[model samples]
Target chain A: MEKFGTLTAIAAAYPKVNVDTDLIIRVERCAGTPREALGPWAFEMVRYRPDGSEDPGFVFNREPWREAKILVAGENFGTGSSREMAVWALARMGLRCVIAPSFGEIFFGNCLQNGLLAIRLPADEVRRLMALASAPASATFTVDLARQTINGTTRFEISPRPKRMLLEGLDELGLTLAMEPEIAAFQAMDRPRRPWIYL
Target chain B: MGRSLFEKLWDLHVIAELGDGMQLLHVDRHILNELSGSRAQLDNAKRSLKPRHPQLTLGVADHVVPTEPGRAGDKTPWAKNVMQIFRDESRRDGILLLDVNDPDQGIEHVIGPESGFTLPGTLLVCGDSHTCTNGALGALAWGIGSSEVCHVLATQTIVQPKPRSMRARFEGALPPGVTAKDLMLALIGKYGTTGALGHAVEYAGAAIRELEIEGRMTLCNLSIEFGAKIGMVAPDEKTYAYLKGRRHAPQGALWDQALAHWRTLPSDPDARFDREVALDCSGLVPQVTWGTSPEDVIGVDGRIPDLKPEALAYMGLSPGQPLAGTRIDRVFIGSCTNSRLSDLRAAAAIARGRRVAAHVEAWVVPGSMRVKREAEAEGLHEVFRAAGFQWREPGCSMCVGANGDLVGPGERCVSTSNRNFVGRQGPGARTHLASPATAAACAVAGEITDARTL
Candidate 1:
């Protein structure tokens, strides 16, 4: 996992609500593609046309935005499926942060696990960010994880553990395994209480 | 204040609290399917880590496996390879694999509870979102991502922030023809997709208690559709009766002890929830989606709302158009959400004396091999076949379409699956979410027609 710190980069604005994971990376893409190689296929449905040409109207296909490292989106972004490939595709596509009004619960967690910052703000704040990101000159935004702010002004809140995980690039599995004695103790106590589950 | 069922489940599973509201919760049961589990297991192996508790984990080849007859030897090259990988990985990790030819093989969510691997007060995790379906057994189950999947394999625990609790009380008896599927759709339709975001939802009240185990599973299955990762119904006599004598269920003295623990798994009378929602199932009718999202639903007799022009364009539907009477090209009566024997019987009842319309292709893919066997023994498959509905083997056919069972592009389909997202069935496929009976009626009528009217 990549450690998340302060990142200042070009941002793309897509203000569509309920853009599900299927739309982000289609099911067909997930079937064959390796995780790291899914960058080009992210948002393939809207990114291309029937002729296999890029959809110029799409935010990512246009100038400057094609290299965007951040996204300002509408409410309930990444709203369906528990597929982590959606997060991987976005991260591979070079997005470091996503500012939205809301997000799917699992998608949000997947983002934290992958070190992609998913920040939820008020709808109005997201709209403000989206407006700023719509233009090439104003699209460059800063996301500081240590300071818990975006663009050095708008504040965001994340639970402390995830915040720390992102800042330190901590492997959660390793962290949990470090407390092996606690886990073993819990299992020992729980085994007698529910003997059947031990199998 | 008394504790909610969610709180009790949390307290029981917590191995250690890692500060900032996160707790490392022990996973009592872990189920993996081919599509998601293969990657996790492979990644864990690459990292030189072994499964901490492989005995508690089970693997099934369902997501991308073919559901056609004689599919054991015939599958797409990709699916065959995926299944082989899943088999190899499960073997190497010392986990049990219910392979394509296993009699108990099915969608993980469906077979887990059916085999008694899912139990009350236990914590279950799967890579697929519909894992919440197992929560109907009073288990604390939710879907996890691939990374989290690898984490669980290595530690037998998942780090999670405790979610707030919400209780949805369905008071009153459901009217005839209005099934649990209808009740859930009505709830999602009333409260948008994110209604239960960040909350653990518990279904309670008269209607919930009255529902059978399968019906409760159907209700809890769509909790993710409403943006709730965890959804459950408190265990009762119905839950216990359904679990008793199942393959993995406890026997003898263990059964008595388990029953005592399960009895205490429900929320206390004075328990409090962070949020409360009440609905009257007495008025709920059959629901059908008119747009791309699951929440873009209306009763079969209701008209489509004038919002979401993009969804309207994609679905080729007009505002104010009644959901019923819309032409459908196909009807899919299966998925983890509604592929149990009861669901098959419901659809079979509607198709018993009626033939599928000539233009409509109808398929009934059972949730599990057990469900398929039971339905066939009950002659439901014969009824479906006589009615011109194809009766296929058990898998998640046409639901995600990863198995090559897809609705055609531009074709409108009424499905009993949980999701109605864009391109979920297939690219350019317009899907209307409905119950098995409603989908069966649509096939017979060649349009979206209410089962009650049929």
Candidate 2:
């Protein structure tokens, strides 16, 4: 996992709702590609045509927005599948953070583990960000985790463990193993208490 | 403050609270599929000099496994190599791998509980989203990422933040032509795809209790489509009976003890949920997705609604167009969601004396080899074959396009799969998520036809 602290970058607006994991990285693309190389295949159907040509009309296909590091999307983004590849594709595409009104439950968890930040804001506020991102006057936004704010205008909330993990580039295994003794103790007791589960 | 079944499962699995709402929850079972279960995660763990609890882990080659019988000689070289690597890695790591030819081989979600590795009141984790299907047995199961998979493998636990509680009560009796698949589709359509985000949902009330174990599994299988990671049905007599006699189920005295524990796994009468929702199934009709998303659904006889031009263009549907007579090029009857024996029986019943239309290509891929054998023993295979529907080996064929089987580009299909996302069946393949019975009807009609009208 990569450490994510604070950064400022251009943001792109993709206002499509119900953007699913399939759209992020289709199952067909999972077969032959290396994990880190999945970026080119991100949004394969929407970003590319059937003949394997890029759709220039898509948001990510044009201008300075093509190099966007932050994304403002519609509500219910990442609404299907628990494919961690979705986050990998986004990160591979140089996306560090996503701002939406809401997100699929598993996608939210997947983002934290992979060091891709998913920020949930009010729908109206998300609309504002989307507008600002598309406007030539201001195409960039900043997400500062240390201060828990986005663009220094809105304060966001994140749990402490995820926050620390992102700041330190720590993986869950490292954190969980640090307390091995406590885990061992709990297991020793749990085995007897829930003997049926062992079967 | 009464605790729901989800909370009870969570509280029992907690090893240490990491504060900030995150807790280290012990994984009682970890299921893995070929696509998500490469040697990379294990290698990462080995590099860190960490150990793994392989006894608690189970791996299956489903996502990329060929569903054609005697497929070893027929698989594409690439798929063969993938299988070889998975088998080698599982052997090296001592993880139980259900090979493609293994008698118990199947989709991870279907095989886990069928093999009795998924028990009630246990905390289960898998790398695939539909892991929630195991929750039908009263287990707290959800999907995790590769990193989380490695973390759980190395430590026998994964860190997770508790989700809010939700209860969806399905009241009233299901009318004829309506199945658990329809009820679930209706539920998803009623509550938009993201309606249950950030919650663990429990299915309760009259309709859910009346469903058979497999039917309940069908209901919980697509809970992910509704944006829920965990979907459960309280364990009851049906659940216990389904678990008993399974290969990994407890025996004799342990079984008795397990039943006692499972009996208490339901939500307390006074249990309160963060959100409560209800759906009446008395007059529910069969459902079929007309657009890309699962929630973009309507009744079998309903018309397509006015949707975004892009969505409409992608699905090749027009506003106000009747869904019933929509032409379909293929019909798929298998997935973790609707590939159980009951699903097979329903499809067989629909195709018993009818032949698949010449223009349509229909196939039936059972959930597990156990289901395949049972369906064959009951002569369901003969019915399908007689109807011109190909009977294939068990795997997630045509559901996720990783397998060679697919609906060609721009072709329309009626699939008994959980997702209907763009390119899910195949690139540019338009999919209508449906029940097996409805899919069979589509095969016979060479178009989207209601089973009720058959």
Against the true structure, whose DockQ is highest? 1
Comparing only chain B with the true structure, the TM-scores of all models are: 0.99, 0.98
TM-score of each: 0.99, 0.98
User: In model 2, where do residues sit more than 4 Å from their true spots?
Assistant: B39-42, B45-51, B72-75
Error of 2 at B56 (Å): 1.0
What lDDT score is found at residue B40 in candidate 2?
46
State the weakest 10-residue window (summed lDDT) of model 2 chain B: B42-51
Measured against the true two-chain complex, the DockQ scores of the candidates, in the order shown, are 0.78, 0.74
TM-score of candidate 1 versus the correct structure, residues matched by position: 0.99
Across residues B1-454, which tens digit of lDDT does each residue of candidate 1 receive? 8888999999999988889898899999999988889888889999899999998998988888888876753446767676777889899899999987799999888999999999999999999888999989999999999999999999899989999999999998999999999999999988889899999999999999999999999999999998899999999999999999999889999999999998888999999999999889887889998888899989999998999999999999999878888998999999999999999989989998899999999998898999989998999989999999888887888998887888888999999998888888988899999999999999999999989988
lDDT of 2: 0.87
- Report the TM-score of candidate 2, chain B only: 0.98
Stretches of candidate 1 off by over 4 Å are B72-75
